[model samples]
Target: MSEIIKIDSIDNNGRGVARRDGKAIFVDGAILNETVEANIYQKKDSFEVATATRIIKESSARVTPRCPNYGVCGGCSMQHIDPSTQVAVKQRTLEDNLWHIGKVEKAKVLPPIHGPYWGYRYRARLSVRYVRKKNDVLVGFREKKGRFVVEMDTCPVLAKRVSDLIPSLRACLNNLSCREDIPQIEVAVGEETVVLALRHMVPLSDEDTQKLLDFAKKHDIVWWTQSKGLDTLKPLLTNSSDSHKLYYDIPQFGLRMFYEPSDFTQVNPFINRTLIHRALNLLEIESSDRVADLFCGLGNFTLPLATMAKEVMGFEGSETLTERAMQGAKIHGLENKVSFTTLNLFDVDKEWLENLGFFDKMLLDPPRDGAFAVCKALTEMNPSLRPKRIVYVSCNPSTLARDVDVLVNSGSYKLLSAGVINMFPHTAHVESIAAFDLVC
Candidate 1:
């Protein structure tokens, strides 16, 4: 039996922290201000892994999760913790990583940005499996710490309308003649419609096609089928009135952007708008200033920045993404103000930066790999075209801190201000935005 320790706080990964025998211990399913007896699962050189056996005392922030299969489903981790407290923990996580990892401090810690806590997931990739023993079909996210998909009848994190279709989806698949042929279902909700992209290993029979068409008509859903890669997806019905395009509207900017199901997009639309506004505000764009948006995906930030700046250049690795961005610019009547290029950012060169010309402001929204190569190339560029101000938005803190070290120590940029955005409420994933200014 592991020694019972009172959990003093929670870590960035949603684990409870406690001290046992002068050593740090991480307990799962235990929250802050909770005194619980734990069973040690594994022991490492410096720390121990445990699971709470009994909760002698519970924290005030603890709440009964809404989902029946809360712990088993991998979709949500912080559902047990209060929603307001979830934002506070993410804010502290950003501050701690900045001070501890980068050895830097922010001039100001902006208040954390938050939005709807439940039913905010507008995008999801759900797995589909056929259980031979039960002679039934199961579809949803994978189980926590397991390889099998959880048997979820409903998902509370999905939009209410989407959640309501779970049972019908299961029944629809079970009744199909190609029941075992289907592999997965991708759900994406747009401004006016919901798209279900079904992945199948074999072609659907005529009867199966009729069933799918009946289901689509009865539920008022658009059905798309994919037999091979993403490019193989096509509509099953000929007379369906659903638009093939998926789009979301940004009322604040009067912008409606269209994207494909496989394309990258902000998971939470509400928080994404807020993040774009905050990042632009921190950049302090001027009418005469030119800006560059790196790793620009579907022009999420590029289009908005173009509205305020004199000229904006967006760079993306995929030519398809650049093409979509160009289309968006044309639709918004800002094509003259914005120009997009396709370049491999991982292998950037000084000459590439030179060709792009001078920019006064920059925004970096790279993936989890971070932008080390691009950062190095920018710092090595001639001093004449170096951007004066930059705003970095990242999903990983460790990589963000490492990149900040390079920019602060080797480059001319200095960390100005940084804060967190609770884009995902119940998960351990943290999204942050930071500002840097040239220290000439």
Candidate 2:
């Protein structure tokens, strides 16, 4: 039976929310204020999952998805709505997470940091599958609800140069000697360089190497082959005259950042640049202030902070990343102004934090798990040792809410301002930043 339901709101995952029989019903593809005939597919104790069979009422914000494979491919969601409305949904998700999860009543909502929505994805791990039944090779993201690779000719979310190469990439792999042995491709795009790291289970035959070289020459893109692990990733033509490096440029800071293709970097370079600028502006670092950048991956934020602060210390869990961060600082002529250290940020306590000396300001760019230990330490440490202000960059809202709760409810801290960043515009990924000021 087709049950009619009205969407009360939208969730961060772009799902429509409604109430039925005293339980929350999350309807996929349904938007706010729209009534739809939904089918409940999965049931939980308090909530249920559904899909819209038909729209009794449609929202004006609905727009045709730009990508032909939008619904089938898992690369993007929310393409059914206008790009402007997509960001609005993200902002609402951030605020909702703060209130419902953190239990804080209100906060100053900062203007969202957003940029070019289309062709914005600069880095992606695409899946490769050789289907024996179909006698065809597929390349791109996986299916929305299955592990099978989606059939796609081009991807709109990738940089134009990278998107245009999907068909060619598939064709090249299909004719390879060990076509079935290849399982994945890592794509990285810099300001002027494009690196495609092909993960193959077997060694490439000489003919396969020549084919890859020809493909690289024809496309002006470099190739890296991996046999077992990321450690095995290396350029196909290491000694060739081609001397390009994979790096992105931040003209705002006059910094050219370099990284390995397998290293973690923001997928959307435009929004990343905007996010860094907005984060630093919100940090309000002064010349005399000593700042610490927590989870500083390759000095993306530390070097920029060094340019403004008297001294900056960056801490990361990976020695490789810390070494790269130090090199970046040295090459940028900010070695004297900044330093990088390797430490397990997750295991830190109040005393450990206190041992690091006083930091006038602090910035955190943690992974999806959020900075639990650091926030807890701030609440437990001497108020004199706590930084006066903090600016946190988070990719997950639930963890951010959980950590924010620890800081505001237990810690002597005031939630000053918080807002969302449209880092992944079409998808439900919420990249947000929050500010806190220690209570005097």
Candidate 3:
């Protein structure tokens, strides 16, 4: 059955939202204000999910999707809309999350930060599958509707080198004796090299290892293999040097950040640089000020803070990340000005925060869970002990709002400003930054 509905808004998942007889319906492939004929796929008590089969009236913002696998692949959702409009939807999503979830409003709104429209993704986890029925291997993102890998040759949003390697990669892996046992491939493109970590469930034969090495050499790429877990991910060849190491540079800060294949790094390099710059500007770090960077992954923000502040203390849950952060500081000759502590930030309380002493300013770059425990602790700690200013970099709007709620409503902090960062364009991933200042 088909129903013609007018889209009212775009949901957090980038689906077009419509109302029919007081019930909400979410339509895929439909844009706001567009009248579309949709086929209902999933139905719940309060809302129904549908896929737009025909557009009766099209939105001006809608554009022809570039990728052939646009609707089929699960990698991106908003490619049908214009790029600028994509950023706008994301910005509105951030604002709505703040108002509805946090029950607070920002005193100011920062302009959305964005970069290139395509070929910006520097990291990806491509799925691998060997189908006995087809007698061939499939490599790419999962299909939108199921666990099957997308039958795609290239991904436009991914880094060009890595995107171009897809076809050859599949052919090379399919030739391997253990192709059926290979499950996934991690793509990490750095300024100097492209690293691919192949995770296999079984051991690779000598022929398979030689084939990977030959492929790496032919493509001028490095191959890392994982037999079981992250601990097993290492260079396929033991003789590889620092030149083969994966790293990206922040030319603005004169810093180079290095990480392993399994570590987390922003997929978009351009916006990551600008976001860091915008965050530091909001921090207003003085030469005499001492700063704290919570959940600082590999000192992405902490080292930059050190460049402007008297001293900076970094904290993370994993000791390995903290160790990497310190090494990065030392490489930049910032060892004297920065320190790191490893503790589970999720488990912190008021007493623990108070013991850390007073910091003139603080930066929180937490994961999707947001800095809830830390924000709660800030509210309970002595007013004098709390930082005067804070800059939060978040990837999830809902959790950011939840943590920001504790900071603004429960704590003495005021929501100074907040805005979205189009870090992952054409996708529903909403990256945002917010600022706060002590009010009491």
Please write out the lDDT profile of model 3 over residues 1-440, one tens digit for every residue: 68888998998888999988788999999999999999998889998999999999999999999899999999999999999889888988899999888999656989999899899999999999998898888899999999999988889999999888888998998899998998899899999899998999988899999999999999999988999867888888878893357899999989999888777789999999999999999999899999999999899999989998999999998888899889999999999999999999999999999998999999999998899999999999999899999999999999999998999998489999999999999999999999999987
lDDT of 1 by residue, 1-440 (tens): 66677999899878799986788899888999899889998898889989888788999998899998888888888898998888788888877877888777565888888999888899998899888898889989998879888998888889877889999999999998788888799888888788888999998888998888899889988888899997887776646557455898877778889887777888899899899899999999998989999999899999999989999999999888999999999999999999999988888877888788889999999998888887777777887888899899999887888788777777567899888888888998899999999875
Q: TM-score per candidate, in order?
A: 0.96, 0.96, 0.98
Clashes of each: 0, 0, 0
Which stretch of 10 consecutive residues in model 2 shows the poorest summed lDDT? 240-249
- Is candidate 2 or 3 superior in TM-score? 3
Q: In angstroms, what RMSD does candidate 2 have relative to the true structure?
A: 1.5
- Model 3: lDDT equals 0.91
lDDT of 2 by residue, 1-440 (tens): 35899999988789899987799999988898999999888889999998888989999987888999987889888999888888899888888889989977698999888789889989999999998888779999999889999988899889999999999988998989898999899999988888999999998999999999999999999998899977888889888544348888778999988887877889999988888898889889899999999999999999999999999999999888999889889889999999988999999999998998999999999999999999999999988999999999999999999999989988478899999888898899999999999984
Ten residues in a row with the worst lDDT in model 1? 236-245
| Residue 349's lDDT in candidate 1 | 76
Best-to-worst ranking by TM-score: 3, 2, 1
Superposed model 3: Cα runs more than 4 Å off:
242-244
